[model samples]
Target: MTTPLTPHITTPITADLLRGALDLEQTAHGVLPHRLPARARAQCADGQLAMAESQPSGVRLVFRTRATAVELETLPTKRVYVGAPPRPDGVYDLLVDGRPAGSATVTGGSTLTVDMTTGTAEHRPGPPGTLRFTGLSAGVKDIEIWLPHNETTELVALRTDAPVGPVPDRGRKVWLHHGSSISQGSDAASPTTTWPALAASLAGVELINLGLGGGALLDPFTARALRDTPADLISLKIGINLVNTDLMRLRAFTPAVHGFLDTLREGHPTTPILVVSPILCPIHEDTPGPSAPDFSDLSDPGDPSDLSAGRLRFRAAGDPAERATGKLTLNVIRDELARLVEQRSADDPNLRHLDGRELYGEADFAELPLPDRLHPDAAAHRRIGERFAALAFTAGGAFAPEAA
Candidate 1:
């Protein structure tokens, strides 16, 4: 038997040791492993940064960086959200080098937000102010805070708590993942429990969380984001929200998905990409989503009841033959992804796909009944995280030890 390679571990960091000037570019920023809250009192105790969380009831955190400028990027890795339902008004924040530079706010009532913040910045929130750091220096002496709950927060990470030393390069490997709310981390106990963060930790790779709440429409913009990002390994979790949101027509969805995948190929070239469909949702499994007009809001013409059925937003596998053939249900998406990868595999050895149900399905659902009967809870998040590690990062998986 061969020996397992031991990773170079660093000394534990301390706040007292972090005091001084630092550089963000030259030194490495320790990664945050889980989702954390945003309240000062709560954050002071937990000290974990919010790596990712469900959208809408969005999460935020503060980072005290010594680097003169900071950059924030989103990974396509996903999480699902299930709660009292997050407010459409939710937004994500970014503090540069130390000061609040820019923020991503919910716009046009759109449920998706993805943008990278860079350059010098300052505090910009108007009320109920969050912690603000003054001028920051450079060389990795900084703290990153994570805020999961509107009422609670946590301190997540630091670059220079330990003694200053030559920072080793944390090789660049993009981790791309996509999925519904569970991937969006709907009701996870804390932000960190989300599967994407957990998987990234075990793999030791950069993350790009693209899980959108009720908005993974497979839209071109989303495809654009995926296509543009630099990824070493990619995974997509489809289904769930499409069914839950009852957003589209089957006819329109088929091509949209094909196009989305096509776009991603344009950018990644040869990087490994995984496409994942949704977990099992009993409410919409065999039933068709409600598509009649939502009387409450004429602008929102789609059937509100459809959202409750738990089906993909745009398409459904209504034909028995198609279901048998695996056409348009969550399973259909999974199968189609497999087919896509198979067709492309001959030319692109990097393409791969997996079924979301493999991660969590009927039996798992029985163990963890989602509060909303739609999204998974914190326990489920842990289960999903473990499952992902087994498949995506293990020695037997597609990626090599380092790439994972």
Candidate 2:
């Protein structure tokens, strides 16, 4: 227990307390978390990748402290699409001894405004904000402060009423997962509530989430980053991003997946690697995409007020016949992934494949629909998380400890 006489401690936020991020950069205000290291970032200059990596989806600060009160200062850069509905403020979740304790949101921070039609963006600076939690339990215990999953956060400083230190490692197996926006926690209520986070908690494995939003196009740099990171278990959720982004044809995607897996095997030859295909998205299951925002329901000369009213939605716009030309759809990609895994598993027994639809299948979709015709809502996140844990982490499952 910390006594009133104990002097307040101010600790510089460093890598020791951070989990899930691959790299950290010293910024003018504080430390900025990056999903990819500087070396990986240097190899590619895609704006989408830059934005997705900067948002700390699964990153959290973990430590043990007796402090009754704690304060965190941060500079969060929120993204605002021009003429689109304003996004809700990102929430910060706090946990004590692995249980939910409290949550908060900062009032003011920077904003990055984007004109999607013009493909231009602008930065607007705002003041740094503070988040404080008080009247916590007195005994020394583990504390986890999960950063906003959707916002680009720059951690400034941490202050506590008592001394703080990094929690000793519990020797849990590390699970490295990479995927698209859904895995990046697009509609999850908070960072810890994301499916991967939930599954990690249930499975009792440390997590390193590389689920970049629009950036999961199987870029070589990301493959290199995955190849170098240490992990006992690895999973890649592929397909949807490639299909929606219209980034590649079937020919290119098949080779890309092989190359990506080849790179990862270079570092972990026998580590358990699970390749998952895309979940059932009604709009994109048969129709090809580059999906675009849908505004037809709004009045003609569409009301900007309606835009800000949170009625934004997306629709798959590509023709279904394009599949004949090698353009991929969700169904086509899933079949290809299954075939690829079946072919490769003959020799690489450590490699396995899971159908994503099993995680969120037709029945599940009918019950809990995707709000934006893309990302799953909160309830769906829970369903998917629970299903994933039971399917992959249970006894004799591909990700089971003994399987490794």
Q: For model 1, state the Cα shift of residue 248 in Å.
A: 3.9
Q: Candidate 1 versus the native: TM-score?
A: 0.57
Over 1-404, each residue of candidate 2 has an lDDT whose tens digit, in order, gives 94443336889888999999999999999999999999999988888889899999989999999998899999999889887767888899999999999999987899999886688889999999999988888899999999999999999889898888999989999999999999999999999989999999999999999999988899999999999999999999998989888989999989999999999999999999999999899999999989887765567445432455665678898999999999999999999999999998998999999999999989988899887789999889988999899989988778987898
Error of 2 at 268 (Å): 0.9
Query: TM-scores for all candidates?
Result: 0.57, 0.96
Best by TM-score: 2
Model 1: how far is 319 from its true place, Å? 11
Q: What is the C-alpha lDDT of each candidate?
A: 0.48, 0.90
**So what's the TM-score on candidate 2?**
0.96
Q: What's the lDDT for candidate 1?
A: 0.48
For residue 143, what is the lDDT in candidate 1? 37
Span of 10 residues, lowest total lDDT, candidate 1: 18-27
Clashes of 2: 0
